[model samples]
Target: MNTVEAPIDIATEEQSIEVKTDNSAENESTNDTSNLDKTEPVPIDVPENPEKIEIARLSSIITNQTNEISDLNARLAACQQHYETLLNRQKEENSREKQSTVMRYAQAEKAKLDSDKRCEALATKNNDLLKEKDNLQVKLSEFKLMNTKLQNAYEHKLSELVALKKELEKTKEINQSIDASLKSTLNHLKGESSHLKEQRESNERLKRDLNEQHELNEQLKLQYKQLTEAARAIPTDDEQAQALDTLRNEHNALKGKLTNIQDENKLLREKLKSSDEDRLALENVIENFRQTTMREKETTKKLYDDLLAAREQDSVEISRLKQIESLSNQTLADNADLRQLLEKEHQLLELTQKLTEKNSILQSDYEQLQLLHKGTSTDFECIQKINEEQKSQIAKLENIEKSLRDQLKELDEKYQTVNKLYEQSAKQYDDSLSEIQTLKKKHQANTKDLIKQLQQLQKPKFTNNSNEHGPMLLTSPTKPIANKENSNDNSSSHGSPTGSFSSLNEITSLAVPGSDHIPRHTPAHQQQQQQQQQQQLLLDEEQEVIVNIVDIDRQKLIDKLLKQQKLLVRRNEKIEFLNDHIQLLTQDLQNKRKIIQTYAMNEDSFMYTSTESDSIKQQLANKNRNNSSSLMATLYNRATTTVNHTTNKLFEQSSPMTLETALDVMGKLQSVLEDTLLKNITLKENVDTLNKKMPIVKSASTMSESTTNEAREALDCLHELSQLLNTGLDKKTLTACVRLLEAGVHPDALAQIVQVLRSETRTTKL
Candidate 1:
């Protein structure tokens, strides 16, 4: 192979050098003739001067030389044509073998290249499918999480609805109880007010008359006491009689005071009992509040946990997407490496095939030369012609080498410029890549912060549960009223009137009615004066006692009313809080579901905003709370009629779709994955088929060392030849029309260019 390739290389170099020498010699002869033409122009008229005649001779010699140069140029052109004809004949003899070998090798190389490209494409497609599958899986997981979150939210809303129903029931019962209590209280107050007004008039009249009677009785008692003292000194019948009459009046006054006190005590006892019942009811209400607050706390904890889990799942899904992206990048890089390896292998195989063909050709040529060596003497002259042709071929080959070297130098300069441009592009790409990384990191950090904010938002809020049953007035006087009444009756019925009177006198004061004539100077007068002062003090004390009893009864009624009012207010506050909480939760659920739905729908939109959550809360609050209770009641009544009409519309409008919709999405994803998997399998099969059909089975390692080196050299030469031919064809393809309309035999520039292009394509394939 080396011997054959070496001779071809030497022949091409010699041919280029000979062409250059012939061209240079022709150029020198033309230049000398032109100089002669300029210095010694042919005289248009015959000149008889000796000098002119000498000039004419010189011009003739120059003309002869010019003719000679022209003849030589024509001879050179004939020789070149002859050499080309001989070469064409020789090429024709070997053209079929060389073309078949080259075509076979080129076809095999093209087949290998096409197969490798198909395999590379298939591999890229498979990688894309795998990447898509991974992306779908991540989406599937995210969708599942979204579905779960939606389900949890649905259940939570249901629970809230149930709780609200219960609360509504409780509120209704409370309202009923309050209505009943208020009605009863109103009636009682009405009766009490009317009766109290009547009692006030009677009491005022009784107090005035009783004060007059008491005063009269006191005056009489004072007189009787004096009469008794006088009677004690001297037994007077008239004084004794007067004293008994005064005692009778005093006894009557005492009876009236005792009856008034008994009535007041009875009313007080009833009020105390009512207060006790109210206190018990209020205690029960407070206990219920505590129980409800505990339930709310538990519900809040569950909601927080669900939210946390959803966030974690979202983060995991994002991480999975990142991993899929990285894996796809790796697959692309691996594909690029495979393509480079395939190209190198194709080059090695092509060079090896070329070496084998060259070695066989060289062996055949050696045998032909050996046979021709023993021919005629004329054969020696043919050998000399062949030798001259060989020298010209060597010169031509040298010129080709020189041209190739110049092309290489120009290509190197171009390559250096291209390398600089490539470096600049690489730097720009790196900067852009870094910017993308920084942006990604910033986005991640923002997402993390948003997640943290969401977590904070998810934290349970403490509902203020005020223990409002604290104002319990436990002043129920439970003394035995019946026993006291019996004892009082027995005391009034059995005890001697005067004996009781004497006993009552020690404990009470006698009031004087209209005795303003009593002197303060006399002992009796002073005694009467002191008794009147004492009686006045007793009347004031009794009046205050009567007032206190009425106040106590009214105070008990007011306390009950206040307690009921407080309970109603407290209950209203609690229900309002619950309603507000439910509304807030509903809004939050909607916002979260919207975020989840958005995240699930668009894989690229990773940045979900919690700020919108607050907006949703506000919107719902404004929407729900704008209507008062009356408006809400009206709307509720309208809902039944509108429900059927709006249900489908609302369902469609719902941003977070139902579990069924989510499930449908999952089904679609699975179907897509299955389709992708099927395509991937088909692609893999095609790649396998391509691999099976690829040629060049034995690798470079199977060839002998000498053959491998020769092949490497042949590969290098072939690569150079292809490059040279491609450049030469590109430059000279327009030099002549292959089908000339004139007499000149047109050069087959177009056909040769086509051949050169085909060979170049084959070399590139190799």
Candidate 2:
């Protein structure tokens, strides 16, 4: 009975240990654990009996097995500690990995942001370059226009110069004719001067004869006095009386002769006064001629200097034009360089995109590795638990076999749970990688197509000016979208098969106010699940930045197109303006020509009226003579052509035409002007309608250019006509000049034709 009790006690203690193990998992208090440790060395009962050797053998076997169990338990405890340490280390490693991943993600985000900034800057630069190119194109067009205008102007000037040379030659001929006429007039005046001088000499001789006659008259008077005295002294006799009477008669006769001499002298004095006046008039005429010659010399010198200066200015302008051409060539080279640089930047952008994709892939792989490590560790822990349960069951096979089986099932379930988690993580990672690769491929294709499209769409611009402002750019209006669509558009904008719509939709679908991905009412378990799911779907900061960048780029495309449309509209407006200007100029020319014709038709009556008005003008001129230059005034005073002034005044009058006729002409002219203006308005309306219906931008631009050239030509012809009018033209030249308006010729063209005719005239005359 004692031996049986000893075995029973040992069996009881072993059962306690198993019970403690079962309870230890639920109640892992230190007090409970210490109590379990204290129970490790329990006393066993021993009794000496006849089967002592069997008892000893049983005791030894039990002791050895106990030692073996303790050793195994110690090994198991060490293993459990080692596994716990491994778990702790793995947890720490996973946390470090997460931190590192987050850090890497932050760094990538920063890099992406920096790259985006660079891309934005590059895009701005590209836009600026495009604007510069447009401005350059505009400037080049302007320069070409200026060059054409200058060429036209130069041609006009050359024609005018030729015409002026002809006019100058004609003027010289007229001057020579005037000089010949003046010489003849001077000769006539000289003959009159000589005749006046002869008259003066005759008057002086008559005066000298008159003085001698006066002396004779005085001498006769003295002789008469002496005879009277002798008569008075010896006069009483008839002979003396007769002698006195004879002397008195002789004195009376001498006095009569003296009176006749005095009358002749008085006549001579009046004649001499007239001769002196004639001589003074001739002297004044000679003085005026000298002053006129001097003024003509100064005018000739000034003209020569102006011609030389104009030649110098032309040469300078030509040089300046050559320099401008060189600058344009340089601008072309700069534009080519800019294009190459843009291509390089585009390549860089592509490479950066690829790098970002690779980084994201690397991050996904690291995450997969963490999941694999956790799954393997969980499986290892489950296998160790199964071995521990097996060892415990072997030690208490009779008591705990069923419990161990239950534990094995639990262990298997945990292993399956860990395995499923790993599979899910791996599957998710693979899906994400596949999506990334597909996106990259799509984006690459889209980029290639976009590049090709851009190359095809690129056009030459006009001006070289970099500072020019382009047409305004307007963005499309924004709209909301579903959360799912927002995500889809984001991905599609960067990586869709149909990139155009995707890109366009990205702007409209930028923000989703409410999303399913956001967690709602959550239990602890559900909250945990939601957290895990959120972690899975959450994008890194870098990816968010990339999406924003793509959206911005899409918007830029829309803006660029809007700018182009605005430019087209502006070009049409310019064309219309040029056409309107041309119409106004043509109408003006017509009105001026009509006025010239009207003036010509009434020239005779105008001249007669002008002559009638001259007397008043002469009085006014005399009043203002002090204000006028004495040089010309004195010359006019000494002029020998008194018949010209008396016959007809050369000065024009205020009423050069009759009031009624003028009013009628003016009213008709006004009506014609109104009609022309109406026609211009109708033409402008037609042009506006055509432009609105189908504005041919290039053709409109060309038409404007041509119209501008025509207007410049017209202006040149008008200028030449005005210059010719200023010069006192003969009737034939005036007729020819006025005939320029007969045909609807451009001013420059008319100038050319007139120049040719004048050349012929000069050649024939030569």
Candidate 3:
């Protein structure tokens, strides 16, 4: 009954251990199931509730297996402990019995040796005694000496025995101490064995638990693999199928979005192309407009220039009319002075006639007195005839004197008229001299102003020097020679003095002779008349010379005025044309500016859209990366669990009793664990590398998108600017106006227009 009860107690203990192991394994299985729940994909074929049932069933089985394994491990540990304790006790008993038998045999052998030594000594001693008695009897006389020798030897032998006995006692005590130490050692060994048995039991429990956990993991892994395979092989449930369909639909939708994006890109490209074309057209139009504006400006300038020229011409004509009126007044005054002188000459002629009549009456009275004296005297007839002839002669002489006096008076009047004409001519010459002086002052001021302008322009001094010298060379030498020749001719004409008027004596002599031979009237009168006519002819010639000089001066003034007026007109026209052209250009510039602003706004909008698209793409990529990482983590966990399960199965398949095989398997497992750790480290390093690079990739992507947008905006702006330029060009054409001005129509205005055209052409080229 006690034996049965003991077996029952052992069984009960085992069951309790199993129960505990079952609880621990159940907890572990629950943990693994929870992890699986977190990682596992939704079952494709099974219903949601069915998956829960299957998980519960797997947990229950795992718990049962763990309990059985724990019980077996507990039993194995208890049996090994009992066997080791029995072996230790048997070894201790056998050693004690062997030690006792060896000790008894050694004692018996020592006793036997001692007995043999004593018998040998007694036999030798008996022989020696008998020999000694005989020797004593023989040598009764040396008996005392021999007795002393025997006594000394006996004493030495006794001392030797005492020492040997002490040695034996010490050896016996040492052997007893050795037996006590052996007993103590045996007790310690027994205690150690018991401790080892307890430790082995604990290790067995741990191993059993580990085995159970491994088994449970294997079952779970197998179930999961099976489920996964089934999910993959079998058709999914309606809901799962619907989810897959939705995913497919999403993929198709994404593709459609991509296609739409491509289409938008194509549209953008087309828009860009159209914008470029529009830019080109606008540029052409702008060029034309600019040209036309220039032409209109040139035409307006020409008209203005012509008007100014006409006005200047009118002004010049007015000035000429004023000069002519002044000259005519001066001539009329000179003619009046001449007419007064002629009237005085007429009065002198009448006075001379009255004087001639008185002189004739006196001559007749004298002749009559002479004739009466002649008639009374002897030769009265001859005296009377002589007195009559004397009277007749006297009368003729008075008539001649009267005629001479009249001729002299006419000559004096003619000289007076000539002198008056000369005075008038001198006054006119003085006026001309003053006018020339004024002209000279004006010319000097103009020359100085020209020189200042030339200096401002930095004109070469060589050209100015050449111009001054060229005119000097052309006029100076010839003018000096001509002046000297004229002076020489004047001196020669004066030296002759034949036509020169002498003092009043020559005048009297010439007048007296003419008066005396007056022929009493007719011949002297006719000769005086011819002289007066000659003086009048000379006066008329002088007046004609003055008229010719005045005409020449007037013509020159007219020409100069016409030229100046024309120049002023052209300059004014050019200024007006330039103003109009500038106004047109300003309008064109304003239009171009507005177009550029619109283009800039559009470019900004495009940039915003591009930025948004880039952001969306970045978000999508990040989402895809996160999903991939989660999937990899799930797969890695499943693989690790499966590997652990596989190792447990391999251990179970091997024989536990074969220590060498177990050791080999343990070494392999150690190597495999090391390899797994290395792989884990490598994977962790890879993940760290990816994590470190993520910011850089994001920054690069953002930069690329920004650059692309900036480039597109720049291109658009350039296109718009080109379009504006083309539009401006299309609005005007200036070439025809330029050509018209090129002709001599408005030369000064034309020159200005040419300059403007050149500048515009350069700008367009640029």
Best by TM-score: 2
List the candidates' TM-scores in order: 0.20, 0.21, 0.14
* lDDT of the candidates, in the order given: 0.54, 0.53, 0.50
- Over the stretch 504-586, how does candidate 1's per-residue lDDT look in tens digits? 33333222323344443454554444444434433333333322222224475477568756865786697679768967996
- Name the regions of candidate 1 deviating beyond 4 angstroms: 1-223, 234-244, 289-766
Kindly list the per-residue Cα lDDT of model 3 for residues 1-766, writing each as its tens digit.
Answer: 2222433555575577677667756875786677567546655676658768778867876786677578657866875565434423333333343344334333333333344555465556556655755664555444345445544654564575466457546655754564455345435444544554564465456557557655765765576567657769987677755655665575566557556655754664464455346435544643454455465557556655655654565565556556545545654554565455455444443433333233333233222233333323444345458757976897798689779867986897698669756865775687679778876675566556655654554433333332234333333333433443344344435434222222222333344334434443454454443443333333333323322232335676677668756865786697679768967996898699769857864563224443223333333433444456432222212211211233323223332225654365345445645675699899999999999899999999999999999999787656644543443332233444333433322444334333433433433342
CA deviation > 4 Å runs, candidate 3: 1-238, 326-766
Off by over 4 Å in 2: 1-138, 153-171, 236-317, 325-766
- Error at 129, model 2, angstroms: 14
Candidate 3: count of backbone clashes, pairs at least 3 residues apart or interchain: 27
> What TM-score would you give candidate 1 relative to the actual structure?
0.20
Candidate scoring better on lDDT of 1 and 3:
1
Candidate 2 lDDT tens digits, 98-161: 4554455434544454466666666666666667666766766776677676677667766866
Q: CA lDDT of 214 in candidate 3?
A: 59
